[model samples]
Target: MSDLDLGVIGNCAVAALVDRDARVVWYCLPRFDGDPVFHALLGAPKDAPDDGVFAIELEDHVHSEQHYIENTAVLVTELHGRQGSLRITDFAPRFVWRDRLFYPQALVRRLTPISGSPRIKIRLRPRFEYGSVAPARTYGSHHIRYVGPQTTMRLTTDATIDFIRDETFFNLSAPLDLFLGPDETLQLGVKETADRLEERTLVYWRTWTHRLATPFEWQDAVIRAAITLKLCTYEPTGAIVAALTTSIPESPGTQRNWDYRFCWLRDAYFVVRALNRLAAVRKMENYFRWLMNIVASLHENDIQPVYGIGLENKLIEREIPDLPGYRGMGPVRVGNQAYEHLQYDNYGNVILGVAQMFLDRRLLSPPNRADFQHLEALGRRALKFYDQPDAGMWEYRTRASVHTTSSLMCWAAADRLARIALHIGETQRASEWRASADRIREVILERSWSKKRQAFVDSFEGEYLDAGVLLMTEVDFIDPRDPRMVSTVKQLEKVLGRGPHMMRYEAADDFGAPGTAFNTCSFWRIDALARMGRVEEAREYFSELLKLRNRLGMMSEDVDTKSGEMWGNYPQTYSLVGIVNCAVRLSRPWEAII
Candidate 1:
């Protein structure tokens, strides 16, 4: 496998690539949500003729293998070469102190050559604000300052190294140190030393991972998925972003690119469920608290389907005229404008996540209780728009249709509200919500189902089947054995199922062109199959889907089966959650399928 080709774009939130030699060749400092500090992944360098964008040459041609550390947000990459072997573990630790709360930093890169001497090349080049600004460097004994507007990166090294202004490089034959300081200055002796830093980082990670309540059989996958989900979270706001990077085309250069750095209300239920399963009560509680704050911030008449890191409802979608997209996909976009569109499913997700918390009797923080009340009021307000025509979950481009998925979400919201009210002893209000849920359920069965097709349609009026309907089984909208459920699964297999995997739907009918199959939907199909008592088929498909993960056991948003190349964003949280959920389900007894 000498011809092994391995490259990754942290297009989602954290766009960085670690080579086979265990070097992070490209990385955008600060945060994944921040602009690229390394633009090599998007395009070639122009300003620095001799110095390339960012490159790291390993000490030896080591055989490298990589994977995320189980149940924590750390990445471990091991390299074994003719000379010797070494392991490099990388992670951006969660901020613990209030003073360091907003610090967007990553640490802990230990390079210990086990046996033979190996030479390593070190290079540091940072392009600030998505390559829009290049900072001036000032070299010091232990650090180099790259200063830009409102952003400064102090690169510190432990060993005496040559400062390369334009393509300056050096060979390391002994132990060395490298530190990345973001928006902060470094005082060689004042700043934490390499040995102390490594010890603290390891302890931080070990302490956090020790908190997890491991489940039977599938602990490794669950822990990794949970950690990935946590890494995607914006700690300050308690908002979990959909993904880290954006504009990684579903196809090589197609226009299907989108930014996924912002939090989506639709992901609320899934995130809470995943965290709750792992016994991370604090994480789940923080999410609800955040949602409450968002709800309170909304006006009686203003409700957005998504929100920014600060819970701001406004997000203007626009293309960057300068920066070329990942792999040359044009029109790189920032800030999603889908907030204005009506995605009715969000109401359901919010209610479900909050209700889960309520069920646990987790008292809302005193300051956030008012926000929960506001959320309840907003639920009432959403009822007015529930029956209105708007964009569906897929965020389709055409005119609004009564999306089956949206209607299902409406049912979920009402059902959750009814349960919450009942749990809190609000008998009268609970009855009203229950009645509303029943009506929505009736409409879904009556209008969304196609008798001729014997399956649920994507919309109340359309004839197409949607993969999202798979969630019906997940939310208890219908029993897995229900005739309607079986029929919908079969219909989805016919229209959306591609071999062992499932597509979001017929691409030609919805997006006007065919594209890579969505990886998460395929896992959902596996979950649905397992729920329907097709254990043998589910296990077979599950095994096959697991094979699709990249060499590092990481998955992107989509996959091109023919060439077997991952498409869309790398390290997709949704895809990882799907893996965790399915793995846990498959590991359980038949009676415990739920």
Candidate 2:
């Protein structure tokens, strides 16, 4: 059975998920949205034995352990067998070279002997078109070429070619180097280039890590979460993906699987906000450019919830019929259909993402009048549909209601725009935006509240509770101490809360009732509890949630509270942000130490 314990390595240009046994279970080519050349992560038991894996196995393998190299994205896995122990250092080359950041579409794996003589087997399986087809291969003196339908990758190695081709055991007396990358020949000896790349990559990561302003406590956990979030970013266009690989079901046998490779505007505010807290604004600065480009392409009242990394629209969600999903869950999906859903919260998200540029002087360059003009356009749409019905943040298909969360986001959009306008010294515009926000808030307060239930509900005149309403205080739509908020939190606890874990909502959706707890929502509950002066209780609950993370200190989108198994996509940006936010909020002030 799969434990979902995986280590990720990437150069921001490309990334791979290495399981505990050091197999490259998941890696896309060219870019995060590109096809999967190694699709073992989604392979089913019915598929060919080596249908979708790239692994280096020690003969008679017994056990293994994996961890990142301190603060870097590099992963080191140790495999022990009856014969001896082997160490594999894996990383996608990322570092400063030639006075600029160089992130190549290459994965470098170096294997070394750690003990008595150990024999190993090299298994290379590359699939194409979402694992629906296998690629043909041809070998050379020192490399092998995998010819796929749309791409070709060369595997250059320093190990014996015959052993690799024959899949036979080979004695490990010295280190072996393998580089899987573009079809280009190496200029230097394998060991020399690998050594320089490894050293430079280490320096680059350490330098990057040194700049982070993490909390005094939980520094290691925060650093790992930050690095994982950074890896999910596609550098070319500055779009941060929600997660690396997609289609990992939220729970077993559930159709809740969706691709998260594309950038969601809903994620922009949180992503930038979390990074800004780290005092690392480079990613936010770069992402602002991507957001601006998306803004430029938007017509009046036409903002989307998601877009391609390069701002390419029309991500048609479809199923790959051939390949079975992770752990034999069917309907492997490519692209995302959420693009077509009318997620009105997107308007507010866009404004929030860019509003900071107007106020934060720490950025290298701040937004100008033209940027404000573009933001005003989004604000206009938010004002237009604050009370209108569409898919909520959960992307609920076959459902359309005047979702209070969506409407509250509209209020947030107006509120932030008012602040931005005031900052730019446009008093008239600021007052107008403030009035708009006030109107939306009034409507939300009047209608979203349920007199019968003695709490605010999911929508107008509704009785069912929604976990998303928990964000009202966090987003500043309502005060934490407000009687309605207090009552609502109590109502949410009674209905949606499962011990410390909380479900996004208890209502049945496209799928049946959600069995897995949405991890980020639980964190939101912690935040809510702390803000409500329940610090001791919040701390207790937060500690329990921390234990749910895998051995690698990473989390996915959802978890089965009953079994404590992480499900959904790995290295989830939302879940990682929870760690950073909770740590920052819960950590004692520096003055306490001083």
Off by over 4 Å in 1: 1-19, 23-30, 45-54, 59-63, 67-72, 78-87, 95-108, 163-169, 183-192, 362-372, 507-511, 589-594
Report the backbone clash tally of model 2. Answer: 0
| RMSD value for candidate 1 | 3.8
- Strongest candidate by lDDT: 2
User: Which residue pairs in candidate 2 collide?
Assistant: none
Cα error of candidate 2 at position 250, Å: 0.9
Per-prediction backbone clash count: 11, 0
Q: What is the lDDT of residue 324 in candidate 2?
A: 80
- Each model's lDDT comes to 0.67, 0.88
Cα displacement (Å) at residue 547, model 1? 1.2
Per-residue alpha-carbon lDDT of model 1 for 490-519, expressed as tens digits? 989987888877788764544465567888
